[model samples]
Target: MPLTAAVLLRSAALSDQEFLDALYLSTRDDLQALAADPALRPMIAPMIAMQQKAQGLSYQASYPGAEYLVIEHAGAPVGRAVVHADADGLRLVDLSVLPQARGQGCAGSTLVQLQQRAAEGGCELHLTVRLANTGARRLYERLGFDVVSDDGLDARMRWRP
Candidate 1:
């Protein structure tokens, strides 16, 4: 399902740190599998923080002008999306929805809109997803994105109009 007309994207603000942090944690619940190792359990928070920070820095370095947008559903924040329009066309830097928002159609609609934007620009939209995230890969595939490459950890996908 794609996003409905009720869902909107707004630029993320400095004051949204707490919201962002919670969103970040929701996506990383699998890391709890490592909690079996008492030593690693205590490091989860710091590790996730470091990982998220590194991802942020990498996105900035790669797409300095990328729009970090928060996905809002009926005026409530539901997720985050990063998109960059450059000489290479459009890059979907990141997109994540809260578990509560899953299957709500908002994300699908947002992605469809991005694909339309890429088509209007006469180029393809590119993104990479974790191989473990099959649900996301399926969504991308349903949206006409094809896997360009896959190396255990990540699979690069592209969608062209």
Candidate 2:
């Protein structure tokens, strides 16, 4: 959101699980709405944990060598990014910033850094964003990523140096 947010990435550690879990929940507005219902509130915690685990497992299965990094601002963890670099290119398996840290340029700055890495290595940067996530798709387009293909649910985008 701002020019001086100082967002950076560091390897995520096992000890960061609590923070990571909270961050994951923060990104799920659907879950938040559901949890607001009295009947659903009781199911929120377990659901979050289950979904987080499933997501981790899916990413690991799909991107075997992905780097799991914590997105930091002024040395504080504000988000997480999972990236996989291969001979084809660098794929951003996942990226999410906490609600409090959104609109402060954390995610954008992180993507720029990833673009730099991709440029240095002469490879394309790749990612898939949910079709429902128009905000993120717009941001990626602003950073010069082009939509290469799309299914009904998600769109595959690419940025080449």
Candidate 3:
């Protein structure tokens, strides 16, 4: 049977560390693809390392001031999105869907959830995407995010509430 759209967007709890770690590691290929650029390689390497380390800790201990939402479908965690408040707005710090779940609207649905949370807090939404990640950029664009600044390797996108 095909997966349904009843995706549960729940705040990731401490026990979800293993699941988050698995999700993070599963994105290695995607990350390596982005790291192919020499300019982005240096910046992304350290950040990736930091993320890996953080994934080792309990979610509650590591993600303070951030809302980490796990997207569950068919009773399994398939994606994750993190949002935090910034002076500009509610910034999306990270968002990823498993390779197998990419085209199933998981990412878009997760974004809708994040946007709803931001709306409840009366804040706009913002995020940055690598210039080479056309798929992600397109998704953000489709969700009403506009390029606010071009930082060569990445573009800072914003959605005003």
Candidate 4:
């Protein structure tokens, strides 16, 4: 079945907590799969937990200048993307989708939404991805993000609007 065009992009509300938690939990298996490197393996769970906490806290109160968008498909929350201004451009703080929502264009659609939001704010978009996450890298590249630098395990990518 085709996903509904009714997929909506909107500011996340407090009611989305459970959906957010589900999204965080869904990434565990994927994260583990990417943790093939001995050094990276030990860091996966901690990093995922930390990111989940950070994302959850981001909904507490609106920061001075940050925009967090939640993507919903067929009335159910499926993903989230957050952008904040930085010296170089609009930094992508988070971009995550539920496991079931992967490979369904949800992440790509969220990126398009983020790019539009960034453009409206007069900024380019930037994000850091693990070098080993080729699937994510490919998605980002498809959305016009170019690799700017690699700091060990992380690659910094930028998308100029």
Candidate 5:
């Protein structure tokens, strides 16, 4: 987890549109599995681009207080973490990393650090994950988060320090 020390969380900005757009694309991996045709894979990026813009606007309108952060490694943006922390706990709205950066231990290390921060404040960390994303669910479970609630499509997990 030594690499965790090198990760920087910075405030996101309008200037990061292009990088964020690309990062947003990286987060849509579930689409690949849902795609029925291999040839249609090429269309994924454009569709996601449009959806990302719409979602960005929607998120702004819905969760204005959520802290939008860009995960930077060695001065370059590599991922994004959208979080909201209050008196109750820290809620992770989203965590995404570029495909090229996967399996590098960056996201895990940073998340552990965030869990520590939440613990220091005597707050629990919470997040709702899509049920279809089993890979991410396993990761969160490994980090000590447990399922607290579930709908058919999503599960809400909580991590207490």
Candidate 6:
């Protein structure tokens, strides 16, 4: 049940936009649920496209120096991660695994790799998880990340080497 597949990270390219958009859609539970209704299904594609574009622009503006990487298993991308590292610490700006790959250890392996990098750099690792995403929060906690702050909707977590 743990790390069943080996994962690798590589710099994402513009060519990966289509795959990234599909991955983004797959990771959005709310959208998927809404699309389950026949009336709403047709609207999902356009919404996903617009949202993905906005998210891309937002990330570029918010973390100008971040590394945008793709998560791959057996040579095919299954997820994506955005990380920003500086004198302060490493922040995992975003991480998302495709629905099909969710339980196949993709996310856990990726976090393990990031944790190793933080340890090697001697700086803390930081990430913010939506409070409603209890599963992901538990995963972070299991990996030694503790909540440093929490508002109503999200929790900012930190892990020290």
Q: Which portions of model 6 show Cα errors greater than 4 Å? A: 37-42
Ranked by lDDT, top first: 2, 6, 1, 5, 3, 4
Q: Compose the digit string of candidate 6's lDDT tens values, residues 41-77.
A: 9999999989988987998888888999999987789
Q: Write the per-residue lDDT of candidate 3 for residues 1-161, one digit (tens) a residue.
A: 23475777889889988887668867888787877888787787577768787663644464468787898977889988877776767888788888888888888877887788778888899888999999999989999999999979999998876
Give lDDT: candidate 3, residue 9.
85
TM-scores of all predicted structures: 0.83, 0.93, 0.76, 0.74, 0.81, 0.90
- Give the poorly placed runs of model 2, Cα more than 4 Å off: none
Q: Select the stronger candidate by TM-score from 1 and 6.
A: 6
Return the top candidate by lDDT.
2
Please say which candidate is ahead in lDDT: 3 or 5.
5
Candidate 3 TM-score, C-alpha based:
0.76
Every candidate's lDDT:
0.88, 0.93, 0.81, 0.79, 0.83, 0.91
lDDT value, residue 58 of candidate 2 = 95
Better of 1 and 2 by lDDT: 2
lDDT of 4 by residue, 7-108 (tens): 678887888777776677676777766677787877876778788787557644534467667888878788887767767777877788888788888888
Cα lDDT, model 5, residue 38: 83
Clashes of each: 5, 2, 0, 0, 0, 0
Q: Write the per-residue lDDT of candidate 5 for residues 64-88, one digit (tens) a residue.
A: 7989999988788899998887767
Stronger candidate by TM-score (2 vs 3): 2
